[model samples]
Target: MNFTTQRIEDIVVFTLNETKLDANNSGLVKAEFTLLMKLESVKKLIIDLTDVESCDSTGLSALLVANRLVHANDGDVCLVTSSEKVLSLIRITQLNKVLSVFDTLTDALQELKSK
Candidate 1:
């Protein structure tokens, strides 16, 4: 799992640097999300998947795990991706209704900050 994490105020921006987010690395991503959600100050998270061109069911499941953990902590989690495949999957799975999706990190940050 190639990724980078940065804190912008109270929000944690986690950028997945991999081209594919699949079963091979989704579990690591999920674990990272779980750990981040446990922190007292991390109330908002922006998962930047701009570099991720492809995603599998496990990848989507990892995202769901992040959403669940964040909401359980009374926090928010959003995803940023420019990949059409990823966007299509979110729509097909109806995850667009459950998770906030954005085209850019700036857009995601603004929305999360407003909340």
Candidate 2:
């Protein structure tokens, strides 16, 4: 559940500071991330997952909720991660098609900023 929040222009970036993203903290992630999206100034989200080396189904579910929340608000959400394991899970679950994945925070920030 430990993370950092920062605003760069209209994008609200949430940097997950945990290594394992699982059921134990997914609910918290869902809650905090949704709260951030409710801010009127937040038009997009970049979830920096550089510290998150692993993820589970519940974690992906939390991510899905974040995605839906952003879209519901007419905003966008992108996942920024260099972890192959996390990317593999997203691919295996076919979430890579649904979620925007970036290899680095810089890439995600740049792309989301342009949108």
Q: On residues 28-53, what C-alpha lDDT tens digit does candidate 1 reach at each position?
A: 99999887776555679899999999
What is the alpha-carbon lDDT for the whole of candidate 1? 0.92
Q: Which stretches of candidate 2 lie over 4 Å from their true place?
A: none
Tell me the lDDT of model 2 at 11.
Answer: 85
Give candidates' CA RMSD values in order.
1.0, 1.1
Off by over 4 Å in 1: none
Among residues 3 or more apart in sequence or in different chains, the pairs in candidate 1 whose N, CA or C atoms overlap within 3 Å are none
Clashes of each: 0, 0
Candidate 2 per-residue C-alpha lDDT over 1-113 given as tens digits, one digit per residue, 9 for 90 to 100: 68999888878889999998999999999999767766554569888889999999999999999888888888888999889999999999999888789998889989988
Give the whole-model CA lDDT for all candidates, comma-separated. 0.92, 0.88
